[model samples]
Target: MQIYLPIAEMSVNLFLLVGLGGIVGVLSGMFGVGGGFLMTPLLFFIGIPPAIAVASEANQILGASTSGAIAHFKRRTVDVKMGLLLVLGGVVGSAFGVELFGILKNLGQLELIIKICYVFFLGIIGLLMFVESIRALRDIKKNKKRLKKRHHSWMQGLPLKMRFRASNLYISSIPALVIGFFVGILAAIMGVGGGFIMVPAMIYILGMPTKVVVGTSLFQIIFVTGTTTFLHASKNFSVDIVLATLLLIGGVVGAQIGTRLGLRLQSEQLRILLAILVLSMCFKIALELFVAPQEIYLLLRRI
Candidate 1:
């Protein structure tokens, strides 16, 4: 069935949109990532304007993340204090990102910048996760002795330490704030929930336990993506509510299923799967960069 996207000024297959949403939603649930990274690119592949794709994907992410967050909260896994702190930074960062996005759009560099950012970040994060997960799996298979936890690190020495009872750690809020800030900027710019980066940062950089990382990341993603959605709607007028609704319908349900499946998988296995998915996306985007395009120039309607 065909559906019109008023904001995008185009028609698309309804089932295709829903199927894309479902696929991304499953990933969102499984990895606590918003799936926007995957969905936005698919939107581009489907011929949606990049701006429209990014903005609308943010709205869709809000719905998926909400569902995932609720599931995590019901399990009492979310870290409320940590999530709030991250949200605080995320809000500020998103504002900056939106402003930069506007400038890039006006200069006609927004799409290029988005693609480059995706390639760089995804490649780095994917490789790291893949290696780490493989090592973790190996250690598990060999029944290696657990190493002692290192309490002292550069982050621990930083000032303004705060306790995160749910995460069971006392660390400087500064690192958390910084992490959230960057993630928020990326979230707005890339139409992603920033979980792909946030999850690893929480695990490796902030020393957060794996159990709480997914839930906490989702909690922050909800507000971050919601803010981006509203900003895109108001500033760029690019958010397609109709498109978002269809995607959300499939995404929300997929997320629920994914979350349940995630619970059944081992942490190492989950990380490996997520790593592979990220790398695949990175490879696809990179290939597009090298391949020649069918259209060299395009017409744009006057604003």
Candidate 2:
């Protein structure tokens, strides 16, 4: 359990932290998420403070995402224009979110409130995605030929026409910017990387191909999370760099494995599995919200 740091004269629970990181990394790589949603909660369950959990996870995502983004960039899958717009929104949104966080911190019930909100959104989004994916699968099964007629969506005809060669989509810049802003605020406040929401938004809303979605999403995450980490470090000093490094190590390796597996997967199958996973997490969070925790003792624990 003891992990000695080379620079710092301190030891940590390396096994547990790395193991948790490994699980989160695999899930993140496979699901195309930053794993902050999972990492923050896991950190809390293992006794790390919420503030520290958020900051550390942000730092970890910075490294994990940077590496992933490089790989994606090398494959020529990143939409640079789209990524920049999202990052611009994300920067502004995170500032607002920080102010909101300050207000909520004074309220003292923010943890419970945030959990409730997380469960609600996760459930709603998950169910919607699941149903849609199922319907799409049925349609594909019924008539696979329907997919052959590749017609551009009406979104492509919207104003502020912009071309994304990597994603091979010509879409409206305004709409994409709006979506990015909305997702960025959520990412900042919830301490999530916004990949779960952003990827879907790009695929379903912006009508990008699934093949390029993951890479571009990771591309955006690098900047979003890196900025987040810097902000937390300079302002809050909450980032634990050592912790982030351990997580990044696990995440990078897991991502490579997941990328390979993702290539072998059928689009429908991947969608269905991802849908199920999202729904399962949604149900689990809801259960936690509805079910009361068991208090074993009248113990007052301090973080």
Candidate 3:
């Protein structure tokens, strides 16, 4: 299949890209993730250049997150202060990450390094989320009441407390900033949108309600990804705006459907399923790193 794209004149199959985008969009809508994690990998799997994949993912994330954030905002589900703090930290972290990427690229082990980190982090996150959700589910079943509000302690006692009216949260801003910084760096390094890590961090470490976590994370992602897009375009000129727009069309529609599906699932069920999917992918990727592939070499000699 040959398609003429506005950004690049290359013969490519249009259906594949759009289909991949649709799948990613569904996941994004369901989880409130930027979906770059899936999109970037899928692009690579389909033979796109790594640099192009990374740049395009950033651009696509900007659009998808912008749309998703708008939806979240309409629901009054975004924590603006927290999102901004995270974005600030994320930007700084992304700078460091970009430097690290350059260093690793020179070392010629960037791919291995990235894969190892992805697998390790993804596995840990998935397992923890899965276990937590299972417990939450059991509680919901045993007691027909919602989980009790956890009392804030040491975290809230820290200095430099800031109030977030939207989330009704009064906590130390430093913690969020620190968390965002690390998340941003990872996102930049791995070419992911960082929602996977950010969502968990916000809910567990930051003690934000899960209901608002997705929207707030999307808000931060827009800034983080937008910054990433600018950085790539300015330095590499790898940003494929047309490819991004194509993906965005599919992503936007998929997100709406996924969002509706998410509404039907119990919170615990959704978390557990998401956790399992994440962990399984992590394990699969990790196995590729640690396990050797079967050899199928053939040698022929004629005398």
Instruction: Identify the candidate with maximal lDDT.
Output: 1
Please provide, for model 2 over 1-303, each residue's C-alpha lDDT reduced to its tens digit, 9 standing for 90 to 100.
687543232466897787778877876666566777767767766666565667677778777788777878898887888888778777777666655655565565446655675776677766776786788888888874434223246765778888888778677887677767776666555667878788878877877787778787787777777777777666655677877788778777777777666667765556666667666766776776678778634432232
lDDT tens readout by residue for model 1, 59-168: 88888777668889999899999889899989899888888988888888888888898899889978988998898889989989656343547886899999999999
How do the residues 169-246 of candidate 3 rate in per-residue lDDT, one tens digit apiece? 888888899988997787666778888888878876788888889899988888888887777676555577878887
The candidate, 1 or 3, that scores higher on TM-score is 1
Ranking according to lDDT, highest score first: 1, 3, 2
Candidate lDDT values, in order? 0.85, 0.70, 0.76
Candidate number achieving the greatest TM-score relative to the actual structure: 1
Note each model's CA RMSD in angstroms: 2.6, 4.5, 5.8
Quote the lDDT for 264 in model 1.
89
Ranking by TM-score: 1, 3, 2
Task: Give Cα distance to truth, residue 4, candidate 1, Å.
Answer: 0.3
Provide the clashing-pair count of each candidate structure. 0, 0, 0
Q: What is the lDDT of residue 131 in candidate 3?
A: 86
Runs with alpha carbons beyond 4 Å of true place in candidate 3: 3-12, 144-153, 156-158, 209-211, 264-276, 293-303
Provide the lowest-lDDT 10-residue window in model 2: 294-303
lDDT of 1 at 180: 92
